[model samples]
Target chain A: MSIKGTDYYTIDELMAVCMARTIKNGDTIFNGVAVPLPFTAIMLAFKTHAPESIFWSGLLAGLNPDPPFLPPTSGDSVMLHRANPILHLHQIFDLAMRGELDRIFFSGAQIDKYGNLNNTLIGTLDNIKIKLPGGAGSSHIGCFAKNYTIWSIRHDAKVSSKGQRVFTFVESVDFVTTVGRRTSTRNRDELGLMGGGPDCVVTNLCTFDFDPLTDVMRLKTLHPGVTVEEVLENTGFEPVLSDTIVETPPPTKEEIALIREIDPMNTRKVGFSRSALEKRYDF
Target chain B: MGIHSSKDKVCSLSKAVSRIEDGSIIAVGGNLSAREPMAIIREMIRQGKCNMHSIGGAHGVDIDLLCAGGVLRRVQNSYVGFEADFGLAPNYRRMVQQKKVIPKDTDCVAVLMQLRASVYGLPFMPMKLVTGTNILDLHPEYIVMTCPYTGEKLSLLPAVKPDWAIIHAHKSDPKGNIKLHPPYFADLLAIEASQNSIVSVEEIVSEEEMDKIGATVPYYEVTAVVELPFGAHPTSCYPDYTYDRKHLAEYVKLANRGEDVFRKEYLEKYVFGVKSHDEYLELVGGHDALEELTKWNQGTEKWCELLGRNL
Candidate 1:
């Protein structure tokens, strides 16, 4: 295992900077509500590397808003002022339906080896189970965005449960809230979906990408102080490993400054669950 | 002359809600908490309108408040939650999970297309992206048909014409011409698709001001206009004010405790207990807070500097 300045950065900052780098300049992104991490990362991208990136909030359709602080929800109207090229939810969908969206961000309570997401429910529809906030636009965004990013803050037994975790990553999710690339290319063609499926999965501990051939999730990079053994132990399924495993780069001075500038109040700092933040202290 | 017969076009919030029958299917404007017609929603709850249907791609606080008051028999929306970071909407989740309200889990595109079909005066619209998903299974009402031209499989969503569309605006004239700050998320669509539409505005300006602002909704499409300043209340009206996060957080807190607690604390204190939007506004804060809010909305007061420090 390799290490980078161990105590200088938090896992939340690492995840934000790593995810920020994935966003390219001029890329149009559809950011869903209830996603504080990705929303902050997108703002970091805009501030640092991807200044030209257009952020489309599904709630307000405010494109490229200079949000004063990290909003409680993506639907918060505080981001409305100074927004250019404002849109309706339907217009955002119109872009997706027409295959115009370049990237979309989604978060799920559960993700699978194939990157299939579930934010709908934990068990059978009739008898009952833990009911999650229904997939708002994740399904359509999955089918429409050229590529999508799925993330979660919790990466322990609760999120990556061995067998009892029906809501977390599994062999098969209870409901397909967001389709992964595992669906045959021919099937997507038949369904008229243009999306290529999820590009990567960013968790609190590490980053995972899809295998080129099978679309199965493969370990891409481990965060500082995290070992491959730990990732394998935490994940539900056997994730394929990268050819040469590397440490995910910690937040650069510039990234830290920019991320902090975007979130001056440390709203993002408290985004992690108390237990998850406590676990990171060992790192 | 106005676009419609201006025979009593302007009315009180209570009067506007009085027109919405108990079993009516209503399309609500505003996205999430922004531009939500909170005053009208409170009025509806106060009036005890029951068994109503709500339409939207994803409903926010307004619909959630209505659902909390047991005003909905069924909701035909794509999703209902406070968004990712805000967690689940307490009342809506409780109602659906407890089998108190039937949820028609449709897709945002499907809902929009259904409204679009009505706007276009079409019987139904063909969609290519709706195949191969559980949405069809969830919403069996949508008809799947073969495309006539390409011989390809397509989904046909029938027109959804709501009986009344309730919307809020930053400003409007006496004639009901509306001007939003921007991000017209489904508000214009709702106004056009409904058989009748009522508008609640933060302020009423002159017709000339509406013309200069380039009003999005025509007076012809509107059924009535209600002047209710700070109409969105806890939600934002854009250039008027931002959402009162503290107030909403309190609502979420009380609502999450349980249905009984929410009904007692929130419903009793906020909705039914208040006589009018003015009373609700005063009870929530008052003229002093509103003055501070005015400064905040105009960008003169930096929320990031003031609230950011404590947050």
Candidate 2:
């Protein structure tokens, strides 16, 4: 719960910083609807490390919008405040098809070891227990974008309404809303997916990267104060772990300040649960 | 589909919507919350339009309200929720869960490709993505095949020709020359691909004025035009007004309370109770509240305040 000798920050801030760090300068990045965390991270990257990166607003279809403040909704007109050369929906898709899209960020209800995502449903298709808002473009973006990052605010296992233990990180997602490195039968290469699948997964508990050889998720770094045992216990499937499991780097003072500036109203925190919002870090 | 070349295509809101029969596939324009043809949608509900198949890219209250009103039998949409403002759409989720409505959930690109097939007058369109995902399984209309030219696997999406495409725009001529501002999210596609297109505009201008503004959707493509100011209310119509967040919040709250409460309180009070769009506007808050939404043009502070952001 506490990390000694570190600057004060919230878990949301830390996760945002970690995700922002993945964006390289000049990379064309896009985030899906309702993704406040990635939105904050992209803006943070613009203000800090990757100012040259292109921010293609998903729902708004704006390119590199300079909004006064982070709006609660992604498709709000505020996103198009100073956005120039606004693109049509087809144009954005054309970019993805032409292999011009560099990066994309998305999240799902369930993620398997291979990084396949399921935002469609929980139980079987016929006997549906829970129906999620359908994946808008995650299926296409996951397959087309040069690389994508899967992020989540929830990391732990919880009991479903049906009294079944539900793990966010599952062995196999109930439905594949977005394909990752490998499916039940074939790998990404064999499946002819243009994108490199998910490069990394940033979560409240830890960060994971797919193993190059096996195409399975591997523990890359643990969030500060998150124990390795805690992550292993929470994950539904066993993930490959490095011999030296390092702590995820906390956001620098400047990065935290930039995040605060970009999201003055703490719009980034809107996606987090009330209890998760209360989880604060201190030196 | 024949071109609608009539000089004056303007008609009453009810008349415009009446062209769309029950069990018709309707493609509602707008992405998520902005620029949704809410007034027309309200009219459809009031007229008791039912068993309609709905299609869109991203949507919130508009489609959710349609589900709430028992207006749809199937939804071929990419998303249907209130982004981060609220969480999942209550009525939509409830209906889909109970199997009252079929969830033919689609990807945005997939919808675009399918609609493009219709626009291009093709039987089906070949797509590279979505081959590995389970969305193909959900959409049996999508056929997986090896490309003859490249020998690459591709998913062929059947043309999705909606019966009507409903849109709300900034301005229009009497002949239905629609002009919209930036962030035209697939509205043009929806209009072009559908068998018939209906548009409601905030203002009705002359042909000269429309020419000066540059029509986004020409009169030939449009079947009917209705001059319904603030037609995209509750959602947004851009420069004219922003989304009524407080009103939408109230809607979400009522919708979340379940079917009975939503039907009685939200639907009855706002939708069924109002005789017309003006009545609905008056019920929401009248001129004073609408003026407040237009304050986004004043400055960033006012804009932030409008969005309920405290900085």
Best by lDDT: 2
lDDT, candidate 1, equals 0.76
B48-133 per-residue lDDT for model 1 (tens digits): 99999888867678878999988898887766777644567788877887887777766677778889999998988877555445
**What is the TM-score, restricted to chain A, for candidate 1?**
0.88
Candidate No. with top DockQ: 2
Interface RMSD of each: 2.6, 1.3
**Alpha carbon deviation, residue A65, candidate 2 (Å):** 1.5
The residue ranges of model 1 lying beyond 4 angstroms of the native Cα positions read A1-7, A77-82, A159-167, A183-192, A275-283, B1-4, B206-214, B297-301, B305-311
lDDT of 2: 0.86
Clashing pairs in 2: B32-B58
